[model samples]
Target: MTTLLAASQTAALLPYPALAREIAALLADALVRVPARLVQALPGGASLFVMPAFDARLAIAKLITFTPANAGSGRPAIQGDVLVFDVASGARRLQLDGPTVTARRTAAVSLLAAQRLAPGNAGPLLVVGAGAQGRAHLEAFAQGLGIREVRIASRSAASASALAAHARTLGLQASVADDPERQLADCPLAVTCTPAAGVVLRGRLRDDAFVAAVGAFTPAMVELAPQLCRDVAARGTIVVDTPDAQHEAGDLLQAGLDVARLPDLRAVVLGPARPSPGPVLFKSCGWAGWDLAAARCAVDQLEQS
Candidate 1:
């Protein structure tokens, strides 16, 4: 019989950064991307996705669901399940909770993107949300970058402040952004962790700025301003895990960014190591392989424990 695990169980077993680094390495090895297949529902909203990938080593399949309304109920906004199987015999290996995997993978990808795109030892990082995912991003990036400064920006300054205070306990110099966009002038790197339907990085920022946006997967939602996309197009390369998905993502869509024109992840060297040409932008459209890869890491941890 296949063993079933819960999100809480997975949480207790896995360390966020370890899972993130493992996933990042897997992705760097030419693992396929899983573009989320979305389905819009009634009064509020939800989405369903089937993520599948295979190589000579292993095969993974997962089903993920997203319900924004669940947040008020103190439940995760996104949740899912994993069905790991043997590639040679198609025998089921194990079943694990999906939510923990999603959050970790999302954060891990954000960290990997930051490492590849943001300037080294770049101080004064601005995180644009204070929810679970936002906190995860802050933690993973701090571990990966040894971040010197971090500022949390949210619709509620109070919540942002609270989150910043929490980070301080983790040995990070964090605080809330009194004026998020204003911080952009001084902060070299900015990360948008919200699901806002409109732009959050407003006003002017220096030309040599790196922005990593992991919000608003749909074509109707956006966190980065359209002007920033235009700026990156002019001065730096806009890196996307999948350009086709970005075409559907709201930030680029609302900006009227030509999806056909933007460069894909394959086009850029996430590096063996190099300095960015200018201010690079990395956009994520919520892929399934990321979740699967992170899940694999969590499962390994559980087995060891």
Candidate 2:
């Protein structure tokens, strides 16, 4: 028999600080030995990716797709499923919702990084792109990262205003930023979740601020401008979740930065994070191992309950 876990059930599994810690620990473990994620491009600018992760007792595979155009259709830009398997028998154990896992785990990853990288004074968090990922980050931050105030901005006024209202219901002081560029300079902590084909994030970030750019996975799409990347690099280390970020992070690539040389979150999360001279920037190209780890955690919780 097979069990199907939906998006809501997945949300119920990991709450707040627990979700952030779980993903951080998983990445920390992966640093000891990381697996390569395979990415393939499909026709019409879509992409399919396979992420495989395992430990002594369990193994998991996740198949996810990236459709940049889906944002306008009321569907997610990314979606897929996680397949859990028995390590010794190689039998598939269960199936989990892909979009939920992606959104939840992605937010957790960014929140975890923010805790380590963002200064204590970081306030009124700025979120660019009022989409699924943007809303997820708002929830994750309000619950665990100590971010109480938030500013939501997007190309769509309805989407931005809606997310802001939702954030307020969560007890977060939230507002819609009609002028994203002007607000960018005041935020010490920010997250960019837009699926922009060109530079959507412009203007100088606050000194000693931190920004997590989760979109722009393809080389052609960009969310952060070159000056922002250079600014972060000049002040602090630019962190990536995986080494594959060099090839996958369009934000960093377009900035003319040496993506291959960027240090990963493995080192940042596993150990104590020290203060940086300037700002910190975390660029994520979504890892399959994170899905595997998140699924494993959810399964364990399900069996326990």
Candidate 3:
């Protein structure tokens, strides 16, 4: 029987650090992302993505969606289930919370980008957003990048302070920034983890900064300013989880940023290391394969336990 798991229970079961290592290896495989289909509704949104690789080493064919009303009502923006199947026989092996998988994979993949895309000796990090994804990115990046300093920003100063305080306990030089724009002046690596509809770092950035925009996924949601997109497209290379999704991202399109063509995460990696280039940008639009890989890692650990 497939063991049932709850959020609290599953949280305890999933090991973020170990899963991240596995995810890094999976991401480096140079496989093209499988296609995803969207089904939109007035009150909610859903998508079905099929992530397949040779032999189905890790595959997740599933539906994911979010309901803002439900989330505002103390529910979850994303609420779905995943069915892990054996590629050889198509045998169903495990079932887990899709939201949990999404959170872990999304954070892990972004951290992978940070660790792989950032300069070998990167400096202070600026993270926008103080929620779960923000915290996950902070922790995962710290573990992955050996980051020395971290500054967190949120709509609410108190919330940002709380998150910063927690991060400080992890031995990071952490603090809260009331205005993230001001903090960006000295930051070398930045991660946008919020779901803001407008831009966050429009006029605030150094010439040589690596920014990873993971907030905006849908056609409406956006986190970076129009100018930021233009800057990346013109000056530095912009790496994304998937090129097609990036083309549909509101901020990039609104900015009128034109890249003769966009490159995926695979393009940034040259034998598991960041390619030599100018400033860089990596946009993460959560993908199903990452969730599948993360769940597989969690299941492996659970079985060992």
Candidate 4:
């Protein structure tokens, strides 16, 4: 019988640590096949995304909608579902919540990259957005990396405070930052999760700092200042989560950086030597392979249960 998992149920199955492990394994093996996803334009400045991926054991497709206008409308900008199928029998095995998978997998990818590229995994993360992605990154880093403190920064004070409170509930020392740029210098690890048309974070960062820039997936959106990208590239290393980032990573593209020359997360994962010296910047653009890994994780957990 086919099973459908709700958002909460899906979350329970794909824990950060396990999901990170699966992502690492996927990267190392490089067996999963993910073709370019199709994006269809909708009437009201919205888009529909059809992403598909497959491996020997399982095949999955994620259908989701992206509506930028939903911001502040008490509705999510992205929503959808992931359909998982058995490869050998061509039978539907499970259905996973799309947004939940996107959130967890994206954060898991960051955690994996941080483990491989970050100067250090120790505490005090600075998160630039207080929405779902911010919350997911907070929990992923705190639980996966043993981070004990966090600083929240967002355009909305209420949202920032709420995320801080949520962090406190997780037994972490949390506070809202009035100026995220000022906090950047002190934060050793950070993740930017905002959806901004312009730069939302920029400043001098500590030499050992590591940042996962997950916001602004399209070329037209940007979160980090152009100078920041140039600075990181000059001082340290800038790694992309996937090669698709070359086309979709607005932060790097807007910075006038040649993303094609940057090393991808897979290289960092498979390399025997650590990333080059200095701070590291990891740019993530959503990929179907990530969702495939999430599906594998969920199915494995379900079988064990």
Q: State the weakest 10-residue window (summed lDDT) of model 2.
A: 25-34
- lDDT per residue for candidate 2 within 224-261, as digits (tens), equals 88887887788677899878889889888888999888
Better of 1 and 2 by TM-score: 2
At residue 55, give the lDDT of candidate 1.
48
Model 3 Cα lDDT, one tens digit per residue, 154-208: 9868768988998999999998888889987888888888866567888645656
* Candidate 3, RMSD to the unseen true structure: 3.1
Worst 10 residues of 4 by lDDT: 196-205
Q: Each candidate's lDDT (Cα)? A: 0.71, 0.80, 0.70, 0.92
lDDT of 3 at 170: 91
The worst-scoring run of ten residues by lDDT in candidate 3 lies at 46-55
The most accurate candidate by lDDT is 4
Give candidate 4's error at residue 227 in angstroms.
0.5
Off by over 4 Å in 1: 12-17, 28-44, 71-73, 269-276, 299-305
lDDT for model 4:
0.92
Q: Candidate 2: misplaced stretches above 4 Å?
A: 30-34
Query: Where in model 4 is the C-alpha error above 4 Å?
Result: none
Q: Candidate 1 on 186-236: residue-level lDDT in tens?
A: 787777888665688865555666777888777778887888777777776
RMSD (Å) of each candidate, 1 decimal? 2.8, 2.0, 3.1, 0.8
